[model samples]
Target chain A: MTTDGSWRHTAPERGDAVTISVDGEPVRACTGETVAAAMLAAGAAFERDRSGAPRAPLCNMGTCFECAATVDGRLLTRTCLIPAREGMVIKTPGRL
Target chain B: MFDLAIIGAGPAGMSAALTAADHGLTVVVIDEQQRAGGQIFRQPPETFAGSVLHPTAGYGWATELIRRFEADPRLTTEFGWSAIGVLHDDAEPDGLCVAINHPEHGTRMIGARRLLIATGAYDLPVAFPGWTLPGVMTAGGVQTLVKAQKIAPVGDVVLAGAHPLLLLVADLLIRDGVPVREVAFAQSIPTPVDMLRALGAVPGHLRMLTETGAILARLVRKRVRVSSRTIVTAARGTEHVSRIELARVDRRWKVTGAPREVAASHLVLGYGFSASTELARQIGCELVFDSPRGGWVVAHDERLQTSVPGVFVAGEPTGVAGADQSRAEGTLAGLGIAASLGRAVPAAAFAEAERGIHASTRFSAVVQSIFEPVRGALGDLATRETTVCRCELVTRGELDDFLESSPFVSNVNAVKLSCRTGMGPCQGRYCENSVGAILASAREQTIGLGGRFSAHLPIKPVPVGDLRDLDAVTEQPASDGSDTGRSAS
Candidate 1:
């Protein structure tokens, strides 16, 4: 699996991290970046499709709707559009 | 109610917002992104607002536009909001009510006195073998990740597809120290005569030509020359893109060479874009097919108003013209909206906007002519095993089987309902065109709007939570104003 560190920014980091749980496990994410980005950063899949194959973000933009995950118990919330807030909980369809 | 509620905050939406606001209209701009710049000038998250963004192009305009937009007190910007549908009632004065949802705001229906659907286009999804794999993504999508979220691709990135944006993206990523494995252009390299003709096609845009030349030069210097006449026939991997299969194609994009495999951890595709006609179509706006550009574009009258009067569409909704045309159209639409709302917009401003539109439209047509066509039998690339629908994980074999059984299936929507091709959460944004193309090929007929799935509302999947508590959510005061976005259905 491609690790979260595989994708990185050219910009230097200055902000502190926010703690958000991914699939019930706590993951520290950069504030203001998206939950989907944090998932990519953590090398986590967004969710499993009905076939149980792992699905990550494809469009990154809102058009594809592939990045929809459960955030704060809101079903099928678009993780790409939702900014990661402190103490936010993101639940993806469990990995197979 | 706001004077105007714009659907997208991309180039056209932002421009329209500014134009409408400058005309002293209380404008409400709703977008899914956190910032005003659309995909073209996509900004990083607000945390990185302090960081110096890598300027590819349109940097100055975006920065200036965003500064003015954020400073304006009259404009209400709703970021991270996804539009669900439009409810147009002739009985009410809600000028076609807009329904939108956010993670925090839940779902709310906003009423607009005037509506402008500047909903921009997205990268066209091209289905080939293993294209649905985890790491195979839109070329522009990768750019969005890198540009907006500061997330760059790791290891061997192979960008495939026949669009100028591929070269520009290659240049952007390479400049930022990302290693690109190769760029596979599905079309042949342009000859000197072809280049001259293209230059002639853009009579007023020498700067764009020079900018493109510079990008090419940088790619050459970085030893990242594009492989012309080549197309990615397949991607192979278990978890992520591990190998990409390539083959040379003729001028008509017919596969002509033995396929070769290259090690690739990722694949970026730029097969051009399609019109985001969901919102416009939902409003019952009349649509016409514009094959070379935006497909199934909304039909608009002289004032940019759709068949549904008081409803306006600009940018990709009208057609998939680029940012310049989008911005010009935004100005035209904004002026038209103001005039329609009984505001006295000067005639000279209308003329200037029209002039701008003409110049940009010429440039858009020229650029599109270079890249949009020549996908000859490109749809034929999807073999029996390829996954045509990404959301449903429906394979070509399944689609073919369904088609064979329902031999008289006249349109793609039937295939969508019977075979579950467009039933996924995405509502077929990624698969509709490819599925339509395959069905068209199966029927041996040209694909038309009829051959495509009719857009159903909520255009995208809306959460039941958004749908459940709508009556309890009162008219939330937007931007310190009585200007609420919810439409009275």
Candidate 2:
């Protein structure tokens, strides 16, 4: 199992995985995985702080930008379209 | 120009331009792209070098109209010119002189009696973490890159997200030899009862189903798995995309404990789009909000007249519609604008336009219902950290606080004033609906006059540089609109 205690190393054919932190929790994700997909694997659904409404990945890709979170101190990073890195720290904007 | 100056040469704008010009009105159609067809009916670069569209139905008709319009001596089609601004002329009533950045020729100002804007819409991409990574792209952008550019998005791609357009895109990808690992269809399929109800919308429903079915068939041929009721929870990988986690949702759409992950190299995401209309607002068109139709839209009558006289609209800019509807409405709106300008539209033409518009609207309503932005599916509402507008860097809490403090409670304009949410480069295409939905939910009231949201103008963002020097643009470019319509009809 990887960090954040969600994803585990599967098999050799599954390909190489990478590690990143979501809202301060460390998680390991696969290579080429979008930040949103990795977060979902790590059980991180609510990517942003809720402003009196629940916020999840709306467009799931780029058009919505709803899944934007702080990555390595940069705000408004789209997790769905962004690929994961080995040591990137993601901040959950509007985290409860 | 005698009357209206349209900014685009695509279906929406061309429809209006041809219609307006036929009414003994001088019209100038300006576009940034080398030719018409926008992105929807985009053809190969070589084909557009001089080839035009055909006049037959089945998509070929668009080429035909272009050919006929090019032949119209009264009309001036400025291909490859960008509209800089709708310069507000103080002297003219409902008059706006447009500054254009003509491609080869310098800038020029064209005065108009009125403007018929059909700026059209763009994809609305919701930014997720890591979305800026290289492999991710909007479904439309991906399709354009592949179909128009002949470039593959990636080797093994995961085509995910909702919207009927995505299905078509996935099919296109497979056909293009792009390896699609799996399709994570976000919007759940209609329930059996819902499907049956949708059946009443036979033509519309059939259209959507057929498109989806085509994608499915293509995927099946390529042996790609199609997963429904599944939401991509997270994406993982190294320098590129590698794996995606899928969560199975219950009947209530609650993600179950069971989580599954798949591997892929690239991710294509596009939920859909709202009416992109920022230019219309700059010209002072009235707006109405209808949640079912996405965010704000321009106010136009059955004749497609805006609050400003002589201006008209058609196609997705009015709201999202399929290609056939857009073409139909485009044709009708052209006729309507012509009639409004005193060019008598034959009774048959009016009827035909009405029928096309009606059918498109019906389908649009169904699309709205199917893609409804449900509340709880988002996330915790109390957090102040989540971003609502990625481009503006406006946080969710900031807008909420502004809404609570401002007098324009629950109105997006007021909120925009307080937080600059909708004032970003992409305008409000991405976050308007979420904001509208939030406002409606917060006030516990329906949007607009009758459970609808307010529609605003210029539904999209006009380029700043395009407006820098408007006086140098050319007044005329294409001596005549030509119809060499050779791209796929």
Candidate 3:
């Protein structure tokens, strides 16, 4: 869509890179990093609802429970805590 | 009588006393603590000996300020005295009177030409499941144990929740050689790129992160493991905490299927901080709700002046920044007071104190990134049998029924009337946030967004007997006076 993976700014390294999907579109991120980090690097806002409401990571570890998104067909995974694994299928729960 | 009377011996209060005395203002500093230092800078009793040492002592800057105040002949320090109420004596010009409850001496009214309210804040009480357990405590409580009491709370501690203080306590525990079974770092929320874009103003952000990193590393070094994205759902114990149920939350923070159980003797939960402005509220200071700071804060300006003239707020009560910022703010407030009194302070002095405001901006943003009020989590506290008011042994069932059935129980005041939840000795510090959260969570269902609770006074429980014979009593009209002007509950 844009570099930064989303069109914001391009990343310089790829060692942490792992592959996941954003609204069915494939994206790459680093290993052991959070989905929020991946999404931010990709320049995605991490909003999951179809309402187009803007959502970003609040409370980066987990307490706020705000950075949730579907991971590997699982509903509402805390992107801030889930480690990036290669070939992980992500779904925007609004679609299901 | 001292030329200046300062309330609340926390960092702000102590610094004000020290600064004013140095500037030749005869000063008296009063505090509720048996010793000096507020909650953030709380130090242990002088008698305890241990292998552990704090990297920085309690009220590091306040301690330095107090030392200066002690040497100044113009200052008198009063410890263990709680300010009962402030009475404005209309009969005497520029004269304000305060009734202080001294533990041994009893209540006494002191008059001062100039009053500086450095009275610091208290923790916003947020209740949780099994939060009433003896072994379960606020992060500030745990820090008091490690830093002030030098006692290990338990053999194995499962430290959970969000907030910088949470990480700091975990670090202190690790440094003290206490075994932390699991550092469940569950304070994550979705970060917007826009949020991080404002990071330039805060220099303390990296330091807080570094402190957290160091604690994480120390835990690892001590053979303790890190478990991020997890929360302790239930703490199980007979007399004390013996087991905890850990659950995984996805992005929206809903628990996934099946939780894992961990056995431990202690469980510490710290969500974040609340403005400890009960004293401010008691004196009729209006409160403003700032989402980032948790709970109600006394509305102040760029210079730390409050809505009431001659009153100032600094440190955590202003908002939850760290020690350095508190010290800077305390000094800035002191200088402002001095300047207001027509005393000259060099322009450079003001600029120097301002560095912390800039430094704390980044830190506040980062801290804000980590820990925010767990919006709907308190709804989980509403199990029918769950204890809402542990002090009064009131249950969630009782409160709900009161809200639904009792015609008089329409709002928080009415709820207080029907149930003794906020009427206990610890006051509402343990229940108000939970009560508000339960209401907000329920409202979110139909209203689309959860409503918030407004803070009130006497924010702390004042013994009714303490109010008699206090001459400076002034009464405001019967208005809610909260940021929302009404309680959503």
Report the C-alpha lDDT of model 3 over B1-489, residue by residue, as the tens digit.
Answer: 345677766667766666665565656666665556666666444333322224443323455665565465555556656665666667666666666764234455666556666655444444555555545655765665455444444367787775556667777777656667887756454367534654554343454445556766776778876776677677776544677888886544557657788877667777677666666766666676665676665778877778877666777777766666676677787777777777888888789778766766565655565566555664563577777765466778887777667543334545665687666534565566666655545444411122223334333333455456465333211222111121111
lDDT of 2 by residue, A1-96 (tens): 232212221122222567888767778765545566556545564453333333445344233455667777655545654556688888875643
Ranking by lDDT: 1, 2, 3
lDDT of 2: 0.59
Worst 10 residues of 2 chain B by lDDT: B480-489
Q: Please say which candidate is ahead in lDDT: 2 or 3.
A: 2
Model 3 residue B138 CA deviation in Å: 1.8
lDDT of 1 by residue, B1-489 (tens): 677889888778888888887787878888888788778878776577566444455434657766777777777777778788877645465555677877777677666788898888888788888876788888778888877777677777889897888888787789778888789988777878778777765665666677888988887788885799899999888777789999988887889989999887778899888888888766788888666785678889877999987889999889888888888899899999998888889999999999989988877887777787443366788899888887778898999888888889868788888878888788888888778778877888776744456775678777666776444322333665534544321
Instruction: Give the per-residue Cα lDDT of candidate 1 at B250.
Output: 84
DockQ of each candidate, alpha-carbon based: 0.57, 0.03, 0.01
Model 2 residue B179 CA deviation (Å) reads 1.5
Q: lDDT values of the candidates? A: 0.78, 0.59, 0.58
lDDT of 1 at B106: 69
Where's the lowest-lDDT run of ten residues in candidate 1 chain B?
B469-478
Off by more than 4 A, model 3: A1-96, B1-3, B49-63, B121-124, B189-208, B346-348, B406-411, B445-489
B1-489 in candidate 2: lDDT tens per residue? Answer: 345677666677767666666555667776655556666765334422222222212355667666666577666666655454566666666566776553224355666656667666666544334443335567776664444333344357776665666677777777666667887766667778767666666674464566566667777878888877666655565444567666776644456767687766567775666665666666667877654564567778887777876667666667666566666766777777677666777998789778977876676676678875443343222136546675566766776677677644766666666677766534666666556555665666665521222233222233244344554432322334331111111
